[model samples]
Structure formats: C-alpha cells, structure tokens
Target: MGIIDINKVTYEYIRRDEDGNVEGITTAVNGVSLNVKAGEFIAILGHNGSGKSTLAKHINALLVPEEGSVIVDGMDTADEDKTLSIRQTAGMVFQNPDNQIIGQIVEEDVGFGPENMGVPTKEIWERVEESLRTVGMYEYRKKSPNKLSGGQKQRVSIASVIAMHPKCIVFDEPTAMLDPKGRREVIRAARALNDVENITIILITHYMEEAIYADRIFVMEEGSVVMQGTPETVFSQVDMLKSYRLDVPEVTELAWELKKAGVPIKFPILTREELKEELIRLGKR
Candidate 1:
C-alpha cells in the first residue's frame, strides 16, 4: 500500500446559523481517491476553493472523512486511537510562517513538535538541530523568527514539521505569502526533503511552476480530481486546465502557442532551458 491513501474519500462542511441551527452543507471533497507511495513528491493544484486544502487536511487528520476513508501510513484517519499517530506520520506546514512559529528562538520553535510528543529533552534538541540543518536554517537557530525574512521564517516552519520525523509532509500553499525568492527557497527546501530525506511530500499549490518538479500532479475542481498525471501529461491539456481557471507554466504556454502557430513544438515545455533547446533545434531545421 502507498504511504498515504484516500479511498473514495468525501468530506462536507456544515454551515450553521447564529442560532446554532444546521443551515446547509457544502461538500468540500467529493469521492477523491489517490495513492502516494513512500518518498514520492506529489503536487495538488487547483483554483481557490477547488477542495485541494480540504483534501490536504484529511492527510493530516485535521478533518476526517464524512464518507469513505483516508489512510496514512496504514492507519485510518477516522480511527480516534490513530489520530495522534496519523498526525505524527504526516506532518503539516501551512502558508503563514508567523502562525506556525511559537517559540522566541528558532531552535525552540523547531523543537516544539517532538517536545509535544514526549521526546526526551536531549533528543528534542537533537531533532531540532537536524531539522534546522535539513532546511538550511541551522545557523539561524539562535535568531528570532520575527527577525528573519519570509523565506527564512518559512524554512523554520518546515523545520518545525521535519523535527517530528514524519514519513510524509503536507504543505498547504506554504509559499502563498512568499515573494519570488522566498517561494524558491521554500520549494528548494521541499525538494531537498523529498530527495535527501526520502520523505513523501504532498504539496498543494496554485503556482504552476511549482508543480513542475512533482512526480505526479492532481488537479481538483468542484471538490473532485479533474486531472491526474505527470507534469508533462497534465500540462499538455492546456484547454482543459484553462477551463478550470488554472494556468500552465509560462514556458508551457509559450510552447503551446508555438505549436498552435505550426512550429511543431511539443506541449508542456516545463523549463526555460528546455524551451531554449527546442527553439534552437527548430532554428537548425
């Protein structure tokens, strides 16, 4: 079985009136099924309110399924006994670093997860050091999170999650509030975690560029997965994605335009370098 599995999972949000009466229901996740193998880097993409965040919350057990099931590390999220274990197995990082960071000092902040899990004080420090180093934030261990740049603070937030030694990490638009450089830094850290640590990564992002590096991509719309494939395969369906109010990476769009103009450029050109090479080859012809 994959490290994370969603089997026909569905979740609904209940709207309540001020009088505490049940008003309405909105199905946020609709029968979404996916399997994420250990060490895989998966990207979830969609427009705002596409149910990506709701799906992510299921992986971390923040919200249990209203129907069907979500399993993390072979444990069902709906099992109350497994909730803590499920959360530990799949750590979560959110968009706002300011909200995640709790300690005055960077190292302390990183140590909080393991500390809460009843790890020995000495071992908590060890995890804090290792996690910070993993995210390239070890040198800033003594610094205050408030003093760091958005990128740096986000890295610290990632370090805090890593300190829990999770088998998988769910990032819910972690780079949303970051500048371009900050976004790059956070993405780099995520890549490093997947590559060097072999941690399964579930990244929910709106940025098409960020999805390029994923092993697989799942595009959601109206609480269901509308597309699922490798970056090349998914981005190749330009019209479909556009219909869903999503965009392709700039290079992919350029390639699509070139193809439409009868240049014979392939669909889903992911990077500038690849586009340059393709253009060079076409010029040689």
Candidate 2:
C-alpha cells in the first residue's frame, strides 16, 4: 500500500438550524480516491471551496469520511485505535505559522512535538537540532519566534512537525500569507525535505508555480479531482485549466498565447528559462 490512500471517500458538512434540525448539506469531498507513494512530492491544486483543505484534514484524521475510508501507512484513519498512530505518521502544517508556534523560544517550539510524545530530553534536543537544520532554521534556535520574519517563523513551524519524525507531512497553503521571498523559502524547504530526507510531502496550494516541482499534480474542482498528471501534462491543457477556474504558470500561459497567435510555440513551457530556450531555437529556424 502507498503511504497515504483514499478509497472512494466522501465527506459532507451538515448545516443545523436553530432548533438543531438538519437544514442542509454541503459535500466537501465526493468520492475522491488517491494514492501517495512513499517519499514522493504531490501537489493538490484548487480554487477556494474546492475541498482541497477538506481532503488534507482527512490525511491527518481531523475529519472522518462520511462514506468510504482513508488510510495512512496502512492504518485506517477512521479506526479509533489508529488515530494517534495516523497522526504520528502524518504531521500537518497550516497556512498560519503563528497558529502553529506556541513555545516562547524557537528551539522550544520545535522541540514541543517530540517532548509531547515522551521523547527523552537528550533525544528531543537532538531532534530539535536536526529538525531546525532541515528547515534552515538552526541558527535561530535561540531566537524568539516573534522576532523572526514570516518565512522564518513558518520554517520553525515546519521544524516542529519534523521533530515528531512523521513519515509524511501535509502542508495546507503554507505559503499563502507570505511575500514572494517567504513563499520561495517555504517551497524550497518543502522540496528539500522531500529530496534530501525522502519524506512524503502533500502540498496543497492555489499557486501554479508551486505545483511545478511536484511529482504529480491533482486539480480539484467542486470536491472532485478533475485532472491529474505530471506538471507538464496538466499545464499543457491551458483552456481546460482555465475552464476549471485555475491559472497556469505565467510562462506556460505566454507560450499558449504565442501558439494561439500563430507563433508556432509548443505547449507546456513551465519556466522563463525553458521559454527563452525554445524561442531561441525557434528563431534559428
């Protein structure tokens, strides 16, 4: 089995009336099934209200599926007995670093997770060092989180999750609130975790540029996965992605427009470097 599996899963949020009667239901996830292999970087893309966040909560067992099942590392998340194990196997990071950080000191915040799990003091410090290093926050171990920049604080939050030694990490819009530099820092850290540490990463983001690094990209709309493929394959369908209310990477869009304008440019140019190379080659013709 994969590190994470969703089998025919569906979730609904029931709206209650003042009298506690069942008023209505909104389906957040509808029969979504996906498998994430060990040590792979996966990205989920969707606009607001597309159930990407709902699916992320399922990975961490924050919400149980109304129908079907979710399994993390072969343990069913719906099983009460495996709840803690599931959480330990898949740590979650939210969009806001302030919400995730608690300890007054940076090292203290990073060490909190392992300490809570009964790790020995010495081992906790070791983990704190390793985790902070993993996220490039080791130098700030003694600094206060309040004094750090938004990107630095987010890295600390990620280090906190890493200290728990989870096999998979679910990052739900971890860069949404940051500036360009902060966003790049968070994304680079996320990629490093997957490439160097071989950790399974599930990144949920609306930014098309962020999805370029993923091994596979899944596009969601109205609680269903409408598209799934490598970044190149998915971004090639510019019109289809536009129909789903999602944007492609800027360079890819430019290439698509060039093709439409009879420039004879091919599809799926993801970066400016790639586009420049292609244009140079075309000019030689």
Candidate 3:
C-alpha cells in the first residue's frame, strides 16, 4: 500500500431547509479511489463542487467515508484511536491564509502545532525555526504576520503545518486568493518540501500551471475521477478537459491549435521551451 490509500470512498451530506425539515442528500464524494506513494507530488484538479475538497479531507480524517474506507500510513481514518496520529501524519493547509494563521508572531504560530502535540519546548522551537526556514520565512520569524504580504502569511501557515512533522501535506486551493508572485512562492515552497524534506504533497488547485509541476494529475468531475495520468498524458486531451470545465496551459493550448492548423506542432506543449524546440525541429523557426 502507498502512504495514502483511498479505496472507493464515498461521502454525502443531507441538505436541510430553514425549517429544519429533511431535504435531499448531496453526495460530495462518489466512490473515488486512488493512492499516493511516499515523497511523491500529486495534484488534483477539478471545477467547483466536483468533490476535490471532500476527497482531500479524507486523507487527514476530517471526513469519514460513508460507504468505503480511507487509509493513511496503514491507519484507517475511521478509527477514532488513530485520528490524532492520522491528522499529524497528514497536516492540512487551507485556502485562506488569514483564517489559518493566528499567531502573534510568525515563530509563535509555527510552534503551535508541535506544542499542541506535546513536543518538548526546546524541540518545538527547533521545529519552528526549521519549518520557517524550509518555507523561506525564517527571516520574518520574529515579525507579526499581520504586517506580511499575502504570500508571506501563507508561507507562515504552511510552516505552522510542517512544524507538526507530518509525513504528508494536503493543500486545498492554497493560491486561489494570492497574486501571481504569491502563487509562485507557495508552489516553490511545496516543491522544495517534496524535494528536500521528502514529504508527500497532495495539491488541489484550479490553475493548470500549478498542476503541470506535479508528478501526476487527477482530474475530477461530479465527485468522480474522470482522468488520471502524468501531466503530459492528462493535458494532451484538450477537448476532454474542456468538457469537464478545465483548460490546459496557454502554451499547450496554442500548440494544440497550431497542430489543428496543420503546423506539425505537438498537441501538448507544456512549457514555452517545448513549443520552441518543436517549432525549430519542424524548421518553422
């Protein structure tokens, strides 16, 4: 089994009326199954209400499956005894940095997780320092988070999660509210965590550019996984993705259009360099 295993997991909630009457049931996660090996960087993409967030919540035991099971590091998320360990093993970084960060100082906020876990005071400080450094926020450790930019505050939120030393981290639309530069900083921090710290990362984002950096991508629609493969394989099906309300990278879409125009360009050009290389190979430079 991989570090994270989701087996036919299904979750649903009952919609209630203002009068507290019973309403219809909405299934948010419908029998989704996938796995993430240790130290791998996985990306999940989908339109809103496609069950991406619900599926992510299962990894940390925030939502128990109504029909199937979710196992993280061999611990069933349904097991109450293992809930704390499972959450510690898979920390979560939510979308809004303002909501996630509550520390008076950056370092104090980062240390909260370890302190809550009953780690030694000295070790908590050590973890706080290391986590902040890992996210490139150590220089601002003593500063108030309220004074930092959106990206800086988000990095501090990530640092707080990592201080718990989770084996994996699940990011739920972390860059949705940031500017382009802030988005880049968060992605860079995530990549470094995977490469340097060897932590498993499951990133759920709407940005195609962010998904391209993942080792693998899973596309969802209506609470089901409709596509799963390497980035190149997944992005090549431009029409299929569009049918599911997604767009490929700009370069990839341009290459696809050129291919349709009989330009001999590749269909899925993920990066600018790839498009340039293909055009040169075809003697169109």
Candidate 4:
C-alpha cells in the first residue's frame, strides 16, 4: 500500500454568525481521493480557497474528514489513539516560518520536536545537527531565528520538521510568504529532502515552476482534483489550466506560444534548457 491513502474524503466548514448561530456550510473538500507512494515527490496546485490547503491538513491530521478517511503509514487519522503516531509519521511545515519557530536559537528550535518526543537528550542534539545539515542550516545553529533572512528562517522551519524524523513531510504553501529567491531556497531544500533522504514529499504550492520537478501533479478547482498528471502532460494543456484560473510555468507558456505561432518546438516545454535544446534541434533540421 502507498504511504498515504485518502479515500473519497470530504470536509466542510460551518460558518457561524456573531450570535454563534449557524449561517451556512461550505465544502472545502469534496470526495477527493488519491494515493502517494513512499519516497515520491508530489505537488498539489490550486488558487486560493480551492481546498488544496484543506486537503493537505487531512494528510497530517490537522483536520479530519467529515465523510471519509485518511490513512497515513497505516494509521487512521480519525483514531484518537493513533493521532500522535500518525503525526509523527507525517510532519507538516506551514507557510509562515515565524509562527513555527519558537526557540531563541536555531539549533534549539530544531531540537524541540525530538526533545518533546522524549528522545534522549544526546539523540535529540544529534538529530538537530543532522536535520540542520540536511537543509543547509548547520552553520546557523547558534544564530537566533530573528537574525536570519526569510529564506534562512524557512529552512530552519523545515529542519525542525526533519528533526522529528517523520517518514513524510507535508509542505502547505511553505514558500508563499517569501520573495523569489527565498522561494527558490525553500524549494531546493524540499527537493533535496526527497532526493537525498528519500522522504515522501507532499508540496502544496501555487507556483508552477516549483511543480516542474514533481513526480506527479494534482490540480484542484473548487474543492476537487480537476487535473492530475506528470508536469509535461498537465502543463501541455495551457488552455485547460487557464480555464481553471491557473497558469503554466513561464517557459512552458513561451513554448506553447511558439508552437501556436507555427514553430516546430515541443508542445509543453518545462525549463529554459528544454526550450534551448529544442530550438537548437530545429536549427539543425
């Protein structure tokens, strides 16, 4: 079985009035189901309020499905006894690093997870060191989080999650609050975790460029997965994605435009390198 199995899950939010009376109900997730194999890098994309974040919460048990179930590493999220185990199996990193970082020093922040888990003090420090190194934040271990840049702080947040030693990490728009460079830094750390550590990565992002390296992509619209495929397959349909209020990566859009202008380049180009190589091949022809 896959590391995560979401079976026809549906979740709703109750809107209450000032008097605490029910106003209406809105479905955040609607009968969505998918699977993620161990060690796979998955990307979930959507506009705001598209239910992508809600779906991510279910994976980490931050929100339970009202009409379906979520299984993480064989533990049911709905089972109170298994909640802790499930959380340990799938750690989460949120968009804002300031909210997640609590310790005065970086290393202390990273060690909090394992320390809270009751790991021996020695092992906790060891885990803190390794996790920081994994995310390229080792040298900053002694620095205060407030002294770091947005990118650095985000990396520290990721290190904190890594120190927990979870088999999988769910990134819920982790780069949304950062600048372009910061976005790249966080995305690089995430890719390294999946490539070098072989950890399962579920990345929820609005950035099309970040989704290019994913093994698979799921695009959500109005609380449902409207499209899913490899980057090439999914981005090739630029028109379809636009209809869903999504845009393809910059290079992909350029390639699509070139193709429409009667160029012989590939229909769905992912990177600048791919576009250059295709142009060179066409020149030789």
Per residue, candidate 1 scores C-alpha lDDT tens digits across 193-251 of: 99999999999999999999999999999999999999999999999999999999999
Give the lowest summed-lDDT range of ten residues in model 3: 260-269
Q: Estimate each model's TM-score.
A: 0.98, 0.98, 0.97, 0.98
Q: Show where candidate 4 strays beyond 4 Å.
A: none
- Model 4 has an lDDT value of 0.94
Best by lDDT: 2
| Predicted candidate 4 versus true structure: per-residue lDDT over 177-277, tens digit per residue | 99999999999999999999999999999999999999999999999999999999999989999999999999999988889999988778899998889
- Which stretches of model 3 miss by more than 4 angstroms? 18-20
Poorest lDDT segment (10 consecutive residues) of candidate 1: 259-268
Per-model RMSD to reference: 0.9, 0.8, 1.2, 0.8
Cα displacement (Å) at residue 99, model 3:
0.7
Q: For residues 122-238, could you state the per-residue lDDT of candidate 3 as single tens digits?
A: 999999999999999999999999999998899999999999999999999999999999999999999999999999999999999999889999999999999999999999999
Error of 3 at 248 (Å): 0.4
Q: Point out where model 1 deviates above 4 Å.
A: none
lDDT of 2: 0.95
**Counting only residues 3 or more apart in sequence or on different chains, how many pairs clash (N, Cα, C under 3 Å) in candidate 2?**
0
The local distance difference test score of each candidate is: 0.94, 0.95, 0.94, 0.94
**Which lDDT tens digits does candidate 2 get at residues 1-285?**
899999999999999999999999999999999999999999999989999999999998999999999999999988999998899899999999999999999999998889889999999999999999999999999999999999999999999999999999999999999999999999999999999999999999999999999999999999999999999999998889999999999999999989999998877799989999999999999
